[model samples]
Target: MRIVSRRAEAVVFGGRGDVTVSPVDLPEIGHTDVLMETRVSVVSTGTEGWILTDRFHWGGSMPYPLVPGYQKAGVVLEVGAGVDGLAPGDRVFMTTSKVCEPVHAFSGGHISLSQEIQSEVLKLPAEVSDLEAANLVVAQVGYNAASRPRIHGGEVAAVFGDGMIGQMAAQALRARGARVVLCGRRQPRLELARRYSADVVVNVAQHEARWALSGIAPGGVQVIVDTTPSPDMSLYLDVLQPRDGQVVLSGFYPGGLDVDADALQKREVALLTNSGWTCERLDATLDLVARGLLRTTPLITHRFSYHEAPEAWSMIRDRDEDVLGVAFDWTTP
Candidate 1:
């Protein structure tokens, strides 16, 4: 018997304000394929929202009618041959690079299993909520950034941005025993950061981040995590310590980053950039989430059904202040 699986997706054409939902057929379960019914998928406000506006990878060519998403958690309804450790009716986290390829083709960069699925499509832990699982992609990126900083106990770390990725990075920094200070423009988001283990929250809109850092640590922050896609790097360069400080750039800066040469030369700081989570890092992140070491439940602020995906995209693109992490709740289908 043959089964027809209908999948709803968001397609992005050229220019901003071009996200639409349409149904696509699910291919037959191959020997290594698993047919999943998506339960929840989170909108990566920093990445997906930018993509919706054609602000990501500008001046470069992107395939038209592209599906824009990377974070998805779902239930397995069918498993293909040669697939082990995953059975039907299992709850799983999966990532698909399907959106990155040509509209009709699937790419090979999908690492959902290694990142959000916890190396295997195992049952969801009792303590982990579905919303939390849905936001695993952000947590994975946060964990990756945290791991790169090699944060040590008693070190001072500063994270720039209060979006999903930034908040998660702050939590991860705290977990590593670093004194974390979150910097952002929004009062509510900064307030939320306080609940996620941020030792200090600074509103950069009203105050200078560098000035604020002076009060937090006279020696300067050891690690600075940049979660905003600001073209000007000067905003963060001056805050690093003279010799041992490191800056990690995890946000999507489409227009390229501008930096003052003297800032790095004088401070002797190391600048690093990361796009997404690697397989190994994703595994560690899921372990942290499963073990309750990382709490992401509070980061999710809004939930929308699959049909409301367009509106959800709009909310994110408009920079809705109340939106922290918006997710697609697919329970209706």
Candidate 2:
């Protein structure tokens, strides 16, 4: 392998609706860092979308020019001298970056960068392709959503939204043996959800969500996972099982996320939210993938070559109803 200078391409969310491609030079790695050459990276439409407008829940204090992405896979070009279990030529998935200052990278993975071993970085088996490996980050997020609800086998779950996380969460719920019904407003996205997971699909725009939900679980859904960027409970309050329903919010909610006090008091529902993924979740998702149990091919709705990355921002910003996840192909020069 040629020892090329460390130059990386990144998507930077500039302050107040301005975003750009900022390139930075990466010096040699320290004792605990490994330099990664990005192969592909996935864009999180909801959270990064809000960050573009500086409306994310944690966007108030974050500095502008933030590098937004946590889902990526790449080849290890160089490993820290002290690092063990990893080396150059090994393919890995990680969530770290060495971006320039004046950028609050919530967590990095959009392009090539240096990462510490202590981070949630792991080596992938040779059989797992780059696309599937990059997609694991979102899968891990979905796992967190599915696991947090304590979904048990034979239980009924209703996942709101047909975005990437919702799709992955639906699959995770299925892998855990829960019967899942994915509810969304778009027919195209609901159709895509069918291919990934979800034993049942409901188009809320075409029919009454509550009625459709009633047909699936007349007794009321035991758990509901919402992946809408600006999540609200009122839209699906009627479907929540009275007194013991568990609602998990797996996306960023920009607007006020308050429920009807009287209605919630009467139902006594539980509310939970998650935005981070653990290493355990990553390993579990990969294990399922290796076993041919988990599906991610459907979530790859939008893919762009590395040079088309500029257009990629627009694709994600004004995303069509059908787009699930936006990924940048970094194989190009």
Candidate 3:
């Protein structure tokens, strides 16, 4: 067997309050693997922030010195013997990679070079730009939320949180013919949601969600999607349509999330949750993005070179700027 040693660079979260770019070595590819050189990768400000501060709660115990990212667009450098429908030079979107030791993979997608399983990689469409595909997983999360409930055209849908996932969920709901109402505290994100996806924008900072929702959707909304890390389910319950309402939980709650089961039972609301991406959903999301239905590029408020990851993390943490979608350009050293 021939051996190959690959050196790469990646963003490392060394325990709480630590972020840096460290050198890494890629593992040898297996028969079903594809090695890629990342071109662009989007940051999950919410998830990465929680992990950076050791607040992430899904998995048991926070692992230190880990790579934190789960989505990127890149060029395939090599394809394994058993891999089909993919070739070197193909532009594809990938999630996670088999990063070798010491620095563990927190779903590793920010690395300069990645060796991914064939199933975890997707070939991009002709019209889909790398930037659009770079945030596929997060976009799929939105898609998952919007697709969970059964709704008809012209139904009212309320999306809580104006972050990337929330915005994406709003877009997906709009695509499904729902009149979307976006609720958030960030003015810039709320404005973007109004311009692109939502029919109405509510600043939760200025007005009460229950009051705003009740006024805008007098009969109550049929669909409620919560994408905030710390969600107030009672607020959503107050405006949920009786008997046929559906509530989708799509955020990361560090201390664990709880819902009012009695309230849900009284209204007969269907409580649903979305976690990860699926191949079919990714395919549909990529198509929607390529067809100009999912508005991704417009949401990109900041771009930094891979070397500027520290600055990017700082900006994400500080919130001094009205940052929305942050991407790291890895095309150069």
**lDDT of all predictions:** 0.69, 0.77, 0.90
lDDT tens readout by residue for model 1, 1-333: 755433445433334577556544444445666656677777777666665565666435544556566666767776766777878777776766232233532111112221222333445566676677777778988877777776659999998888878888888888889989999898888888888748899998999877889888887778999888773467565667778678898887766778777778787778877766566666677788878778887778888776776777777767777888777776764
| lDDT of each residue in 190-295, candidate 2, tens digit only | 8888877799999888988888888888888899999886666776677777777888988776665777777766787777888777788789888887776767
| Sliding window of 10 residues with minimal summed lDDT for model 3 | 1-10
Query: Highest TM-score, which number?
Result: 3
Give candidate 3 regions above 4 Å deviation. Answer: none
Better of 2 and 3 by lDDT: 3
lDDT of 1: 0.69
Worst 10 residues of 1 by lDDT: 105-114
Candidates in descending lDDT order? 3, 2, 1
All candidates in order of TM-score, best leading:
3, 2, 1
Off by over 4 Å in 1: 2-15, 97-123, 261-266
Q: Model 3 reaches what TM-score against the true structure? A: 0.97
**Candidate 2 residue-wise lDDT at 62:** 53
Consecutive 10-residue window with the lowest summed lDDT within model 2: 111-120
